[model samples]
Target: MLLAYIDEIGQTGAFVSPTHARFSDSPAFGYGGFVIPAEAAREFGAYFNKQKRTLFKNEIPEGTDPNRWEKKGSDLLFARVSDDRPQNLRVFRSLISKLDALNGKLFYYAAEKPCGTPKETNTGPREFEAREENAMRETLNRLARHADSGKQQIMVMMDQINEKSRKQRLPVMYAHILGRATEHEDMRRIVEPPMHIDSSLSANIQFADWVCALVKRSIEYQLVPTSRYSWIPKETQLLRDKEIFTFESKLHLFHRAVDDICHSRILLEYRPVIDPLHTSTMNEENRKNLSESGKLHSVNKLEQPTNHAKAP
Candidate 1:
């Protein structure tokens, strides 16, 4: 069996419209994390803790409380150049190397948040949660495939979310999805429901936070094209070389995967607002086609909206 620790990089709030001021700040949303064999989970956590203590021993204040001893990814990766740049960079690289040697795999799903009115958006009349659910579904599906290939099942643990609705209801939502996934392999490979754990207790979840931060930073660099964060891109290149880091630069196109399997690509769907006249014309054409084929079904059921619809 494998254990996967999942974390999110950006917010999944109900702020899909560009008119919202905060939309500009976080135009993209991401979900990612790392997966390792069950046996390796404990060893990796212990090794990571030891590495942190040894590498940052000098930075720790004398007699500092053990609970306060924390090294966050944001501070380590985005630190100012004057703040132990060489040492911190070395530690970060060493961490990545250790993860690679341990056979940890990284997977993620990211998308540009849908903008415009409900009808104009890729997902008509859907809230931001829908967009997040789509990403989650895709990620879980991939995890299912991975588990099946290894002849093992997977259990997922995510960093705790404080929101009552999200924290309590997300498990139920995932259960419903997995329950209805009769045609997919997720039902078999993903045996256990996703469990939430605090980052302080689960070092694996903390590592996932680091992976998510790195992925989000890489995507942000592409969106803005700035030279200030040169280290991010460099580290991202190393991540791609080491693990199964996957990225979706745009809808319907994927990059940076270990294997570029065409059949595994997620088909992106785009929906434009249809005018009344055009809708009527399409309906008429559909009826004509159905009549020609002696079938009463006028519209394509596959084209109709389903729970699997995702943002473009």
Candidate 2:
């Protein structure tokens, strides 16, 4: 069996730019972390717990139980994104090595937000039952593929959320876990319903938070040069690290393991491009579908939104 520990890596809501006043926090939103053998999970969790205590003793909160207390991944990344100092870098690199030793690898799948203005469809009320349902299905399809390739059952675990928010996502979960697959492979490879574990109880879950934080921050740094974090060699007060990659650009290198684990293996769902001003890249099919007058392509029969709908 394969154990996949994952957490939300980025915001799923509207993001016009890094500097957008109302919606500027993240350029992407999806899930990420690491996957390892089931038998190795306990060992990895123990290692993670030791590292968290050793590296973040001061930030572990005053009154909380050490075992139950958790360090937020965003906070850890904020403290360690600087690439000049090697201490923190060594720590993160060591963690990476630990995971690698277990045959685990980093993995992430994200939806690149439509850059520029984001607006609701001007047509009737709404076309889909849930707005981000496609994104969720895309995530599951990727997971299913990952599990199938390894020929092992994968059990996905994510950090717990609030009751109200959790309740809202239940429908999406039910559709994927209990519902059948249409057009795509049924997620029988994945042993769902996914477990939602508290980060405090599971060191692996906490480590997942860190992995996801790195992914989120790295993407932000790439999308916005002005982003305060750096995977490059530089002087930042909080965390200067000896470094993971020595090149000027580490996104390609960093994503190498990531793609092998899942990215390159993905069969993407067709999504209608929404860039009204045409500032982003478009594939050949999308370009060919464009009208002679250069307007956005109309949704054809095969291209209809219902084509991407979940199984009934």
Candidate 3:
């Protein structure tokens, strides 16, 4: 069994942007992917639960009422500081930093459009969308390379997004990549299981809760790193356009909050080789060779075809 832990980074709601009206106004697009071996899945789940407990206690104190917490809107969090924003840029940078720090090979697919693009506008082509699809294909191809030798099974889990437009992108992207995997006979047998968690029931709610707690911690501690701060650049840019200052500061704070949360939760280390026999292609090949050493079959051997003739 293979398990992929997936999460998306972006807003699924409609927002206005000067560049395009219909584009997802979400500032950044990101997905965190991890392929977990079958035997390790349950163990990882338990580990994740433990981590969650620690995070909750650290962020929300033990006696606090968890029911009072609700998912905070990213936009709303930044709104007080800037009518237009710079916070998203900080969040974007932090995400990139976190991705860079991740230890094991992780597959990431992201499409980021400038904020404020309306959902209805029919802009011609989106470069970010193309980039995201390409990334997904490349990642899938890498996985298929290992899978073709019967080394690994593909399993994925991801956070659900709200935009109907973006919802279709993932499966289509997967299909395109899988099409290229046809060259490997073993790759042809790979199957993608239906997505496991329902957004309304379990995973989504849990993710929202996690984000909320993180955000609150950010706000309480003013934990945004100075180096990661968005103001340094925005301060310079604002000299040319004074109007940006008002929104930039607010956006910066909001993003700093997001950065703090993201930095803390990023998965650092994970053991990928769970089942040594299945995970190692070389081992499997050696085992197969040994098993087939004495086997013999006629070159023309074929099972008789089943007969269910019609009255042709």
- Estimate the TM-score of every prediction: 0.67, 0.67, 0.40
Question: What is the C-alpha local distance difference test score of candidate 1?
Answer: 0.58
Best to worst by TM-score, what's the order?
2, 1, 3
Candidate 1 wrong stretches, greater than 4 Å: 13-25, 58-68, 79-84, 115-126, 166-168, 243-312
Candidate 2 colliding pairs: 83-241, 84-240, 84-241, 85-240, 85-241, 86-242
Candidate 2 lDDT at 296 equals 41
TM match of model 1 to true structure: 0.67
* Model 3 alpha-carbon miss at residue 185, Å: 5.2
How badly does each model clash, as a count of residue pairs?
0, 6, 9
Using lDDT as the measure, the top candidate is 2
Model 2 per-residue lDDT tens digits across residues 1-312: 888787886665666676678777676667777788899999988887787678768777788777677878776667344544445556776787787778776667665554544564221213222434555565566666667667878888888888887787767776776665554554787777567888888888888888777767656654554666644223221221222210111122222222111231121111112222231466667666664433343223213333222221
**Model 3 TM-score, all chains together:** 0.40
Q: Over the full model, what C-alpha lDDT does candidate 3 score relative to the true structure?
A: 0.36
lDDT of 1 by residue, 1-312 (tens): 888888886665423432355443343565777778888899888876777778778888899843337777676667353244756666666777776787767766666554443455544324576766766766666667667767888888888777895665578657855675677655577866677787878778877887776655554443333323445533444554453543321222223222221111211111111111122356667667655753332123214444532332
Q: Which ten residues in a row have the lowest lDDT in candidate 3?
A: 295-304
Candidate 3: pairs in clash: 6-157, 16-116, 17-116, 17-117, 21-117, 21-118, 22-118, 82-247, 87-251
**Cα lDDT, all candidates:** 0.58, 0.59, 0.36
Better candidate number, 1 or 2, judged by lDDT: 2
